[model samples]
Target: MLLKKERLNDILTDMAKQARVYVPVSPDANDGGGVGKSGKAKMTRFELYSPGTAPNFDLVNTTMPPKDMLFPQTQKMYRYGFDTEGNAYIDIIHDSDEVVIFGMRSCDARSIECMDDVFLSMGYDDEFYKQRREKLATVAIGCASVAETCFCDSMGLDPNAAPGADVQLSPGVDGQSYVVVAQSEKGQALVASWQPYLEDSTAETTQVSCALKVNGDGLKDKLEQMFDHPIWEQLSKKCLTCGTCTYVCPTCHCFDISQENKMKDGERFRCWDSCMFSAYSEMAGNHNPRPTKMPRVRQRFMHKLCFFEDRYGKTLCVGCGRCVEKCPVALDITMLIDDIQAADLSKAEEVA
Candidate 1:
């Protein structure tokens, strides 16, 4: 099926009538200049599509990953309160809206697979994550242009395809349409609805390749033996421990659970957390094991490359380049991988 560029808004308008459609939005307006107060451009991110809202399909990738839709930054678990008769009541809160992520890239699609491992697999299922995952649909677009910092190909992802997405869209000839393929029942239903806007025609996809590449082969094995090595110390020296990398990462899923209370009611919630923060590892007795920046920095990278692979059979980093593009101090993960590949592990300590 070919989805023409001219009919995109109409298709979106039609889809929005049934579900909350999220598309990458870039506010590069005629007068807005797109710069936010933080000096960063009003960056591209998945936004809920409403009437008259413009979705930017030209963007390579969103600065903010779409992970927030599935696993929110601060999700209220439940509410508890005491009634006037002194009876305690509890209410479970689950906000599962039928949603579709349109125009997501392949890296974004893979990251959702990673989250599935953490939340829905391994003989355990989180009700909160399951609630959202079950109702969500993905429409991934093939990358026609690669960013300078993009390394998805090196991280074992295909830039031209998202196998996990329900529907895959790739730019067609002359950039006039998208070659759409439905890979699932949900995708079939979605594409069926777009039948009014699609054409029964065949077309070729515009292929693309990432400019940045890294040798990640054996990186996990090498890092396992180098945990106590001096490389971590060297890498930690320049890091400001700002946790910007985790915030912008597509696969970083660490979170902290807490609660907010009112006079007679309270709600438990979980918000995104960062291992780069010293307090994240603080014990109840104030015994901080990862008290210094060295261990904190080591934990972040080790989890991304080694620890996560050991548990999930895949690396956590999706190579979306959000961290690389947003990092204030130029602390790049590709550079770290390069360093680890070159490190001499002759006397490297055993895996911790």
Candidate 2:
């Protein structure tokens, strides 16, 4: 099913009439905590909220990842109580309403699918992630222009490729139309429901939208032998150990679990955590697995490029480049990959 570029929000508002619709909303003064110095104007910062105005579809990328829809920063699992008989009762807090995540990028939507391998079918199953995953539908939009920090190409992601979107919208060469394709059964259902907005796809539209492409097949093997290369040290020098890179990363899934208590009743909450922090993996005895910034840096890349590939047959990174722009030290992952590509690793020991 193909939808017109002009009717995007009309379709969204229609969906919202029946279910909850979440689009990327830019920051207002209320988003970043308090008012500015004048105390009158709301300071605008980057935040993801419900769309107050219609979305700007031609924009490159969003400030935040679409992870919150899949793995919320903080979610309540259940509430427990004891009656007079001391019998424990628990109430599950589940997402009952259907949610449509409109105007998502292919990279961001694909990242959610990558995360599903870990949280859904792996050794452990998270009821929260599973429930939300089942309740949500993703509508992916193609990138019209690439950012300076974007390296979706290096990660073998196409700016126009739709890996995990239920429905993908590719802008036509005419610049006024779109090519819509449904990649899944759910996507097909969605397109069928929005039949009024869709039209038949044209071969011309498909060819024009995906002109940008990259090959990342040898990336994992390339990173393996280049682990000890000098690029690691050079890149680490610019890093501030700030967690922004992972925090804004669409596919980075490291989180910390904590318990909040109130008298006899305590609630367990999980929030976003980063691997860059020195205390991230600190044990009860204060022993840290990653003792230095270099190791921490190494851990992030290795996990994204190596460990994730080893486990799921895909690289963890979607190459959205949120880290490149958000980092205080200007630690760019694309440049690091380019440096890795330049290294002569014929003599280095291979890593699996």
- Per-model TM-score, in order, reads 0.96, 0.85
**How far is each candidate from the true structure, as Cα RMSD in Å?**
2.0, 4.0
Winning model by lDDT: 1
* Clash list (residue pairs), candidate 1: none
Off by over 4 Å in 1: 30-41, 347-352
RMSD of 2: 4.0
lDDT of 1 by residue, 41-140 (tens): 6767888998788888889989899999998889889999998998999999988589999999999999999999999999999999999999999999
* Location of the lowest summed lDDT over 10 successive residues in candidate 2: 40-49
Cα displacement (angstroms), candidate 1, residue 239, comes to 0.8
- Among these predictions, the greatest TM-score belongs to 1
lDDT of candidates 1 onward, in order: 0.90, 0.73
Candidate 1 accuracy as lDDT: 0.90
